[model samples]
Target: MPKNSYKIPSSLNRSFLDHEVALSGGGFQAKPLPMKVLLFWSGSILTLFWVASSTFVAQAAWWLIALVVIWWLITTAFLGQYSKTKEMKFASVPALLAYVPAAARRVLTRTSTNPSSFYSVVGIDNISATGLIKYSDGTLGQGYLVVGSASILLFEEDRKAILNRVDSFWRKVDTSCEYTFVTTKEPQRVYHQIANLERRNLALEVRDPELKELMDEQYDILNDYVGKQFASIHQYLLLKGDNLESLRRAHSVLQAEVENSSLMIKGCTMLNGDEVTDMLTVLYKGKSS
Candidate 1:
């Protein structure tokens, strides 16, 4: 029998973050405390105290000692789980409140001034572009959003890594489509060519004011949904101690809602070729040759 092999798509493979890219402009490098070392030392000290108390000082019964050990183990496990979940909650809350809103407004921008950091883009465009880049320093993963003028590109990797490569990729695409744009004097034609090369063919233009208004309404609904979902999770975590199942359920529902919102937003924002062309022209009008 043939062995089964699972392959992650190239877009999802973000091993590049492990090694420094030549073109990566420097960004901030996070210098978090060595959590593992702290945890190890704390656990060791606690274990020693527990053993000494059970064996030498208290002379506790076997049953009592066993119960103490069991309790210690359970407490340690619960604390570990709680700590992880809390970190995730903290990270997600800001994205829900700030990042999503900014992206929806289409005024979101990223500053990769740090020599060791990058950010990611999220949300969908009219071209059905939605993906995230996950960046990892072999221990932590950060996500970045990919935004484009005509068609967005999605990847499952870190934002910093994507940002590092963005210039090169944009230049390559521009080189490929420049001739078409210059010859035809049509931004749409260049957009189509670039989209074709990038394997993003779904392009829509939104000219209807009513449809745009409706999409904005739907975006409001999605924002409300996210807020409610987050609140429920927060309440559950506070009232009940770090219920993993509850967190998972909340996240699952939110993910589904976000996906639905992406589709809806894409449909509502679909821009025709002319509109896309004009937008691109305006955006790049200030660029130097």
Candidate 2:
């Protein structure tokens, strides 16, 4: 966690065995220009020719032709230079020719119908009491809240030890099962404390005047801080397997790793039904209800 300390070398690496057959049976090159860039440039070239031909037929002004040519050169040159970067390799074409037209067609041909429920769309059947989430496809998953890891506050040597333990933990994990780690910032319900305080004040049968004034001041302070509170970062880990038995095995391995092999994890609390629902809402809907 230190700014300039040594990093643990990653144990996860692509195996040549995985790509051996594909490499030998070659079709397209391993890496090429993104499809979106190819499409955009192709469309640009066709549009350029079409405009030029149409101008010739209409006897357009000479300045018009020069302006179009200059614009085309500038755009193509700029894009060509920009596309040299690694990020542009995954660029997508504009939605005007694809998504926008499809959306417009859908609107024009709209029909009244009930929308599908969120659970149906996400393919989640239920979250069990013991923190197992059963999906429509029969997969069982368990979610855990990573409460805290204090590696950032540790000295250099301690941080390195934590990193080594983390690496060992990953290496010892069951590779066949699926695991996902997510980190996100979610807004905390800072208004709840004030609301609860107000409720308690109202429910009191006998309240001292002095105590009441202090409570009112407390409520005012909390109310003022409501919207200014910082969002808390949450880290989650999901372990998934094909069936209950495999899921249990994975969970055992996870517990063992945390207790015996890893010093990087401070706590891992399993999520119940409500907690699972809240986590899902934060992940997909971008806010927790």
Candidate 3:
């Protein structure tokens, strides 16, 4: 939990290994430049420039030849410079690297007119949860935005808040624990299901018959916070685990964590929602009565 501490729990460590989930094979992807892809777009732009020069400006044949030469020189020179700068940025950017595997696209994505292979950028637009991105060698990869470990520090409510926490987590994760993000269409409604039950049980706990509805409302927010934790863990697993064994282990760990925080998670049964509710009610009543 400390800023500098890099240790993971025994079970979580096993889960990480079991998943074998890595965003990249190495420090960075080494895809080569896709010259043909680059040429297609660059050629289109050059053609337009030539047409404008000849038709609008009344440039003669020799002038046209000179313009083409100038365009090639400028394109090639700029491309070379761009590639060097991009490599530099990729190698040095701190905390920012968290977004690289997904955010950083290879040079081919930009369709840059820079004739040099080194002048390409990772991607030209903003990074996001899901978007098609082209790599330097013209291979297209989907952007996968994820929720991070750090996000667990704060409770998740909205998608943006969840994303920010995920962003924060990846920035801190020195290890290979990949994080992920997702949204439920009915987060609020689903959250209230457990919350309503918790409040119903809590109300029965005390005979202070005053402000029952008000008391229930007060607990509503707390319940929502608990629900968000569940959602975060679920999304995290989906992003990290691609195999059945790993998902199974992750589910086990999640159930254990939920039970460890029993008061909030309401006993954290391994059973499905219906069974969980039954167990929660029985446990709550045993204590209340």
lDDT of 2 at 170: 69
Per-residue lDDT tens digits of candidate 2, residues 37-109? 5555677788888877775733677788878878986776565432323323223345344555653334221
- Quality of model 2 by C-alpha lDDT: 0.68
CA lDDT, every prediction?
0.36, 0.68, 0.41
> Candidate 1 on 26-60: residue-level lDDT in tens?
68554342344245437756885778585563587
Residue 216 of model 1, lDDT score? 57
Better of 1 and 2 by lDDT: 2
On the 0 to 100 scale, the lDDT of residue 140 in model 2 is 86
Which 10-residue window of candidate 1 scores lowest in summed lDDT?
A: 232-241
How many clashes does each candidate structure show, in the order listed? 28, 0, 9
Question: Where does candidate 3 have its weakest 10-residue lDDT segment?
Answer: 121-130
| Candidate 3 residue runs with Cα over 4 Å from true position | 1-62, 77-178, 183-187, 190-237, 240-242, 249-289
Preferred candidate (lDDT higher): 2 or 3? 2
Best by lDDT: 2
Give the alpha carbon lDDT tens digit for every residue of 1-289 in model 3.
2243455444532322123222346577544433432453466567756765666444567777668667866655453332422232222346466547653433332345453432332222321233322234433322221232333454534444445443454554423222333332222226456666666766685666566676666566556564444432222122233343444454455445454532222232223334323322332333323
How accurate locally is residue 162 in candidate 2, as Cα lDDT from 0 to 100? 76
Could you say which candidate leads in TM-score?
2
Off by over 4 Å in 1: 1-60, 77-289
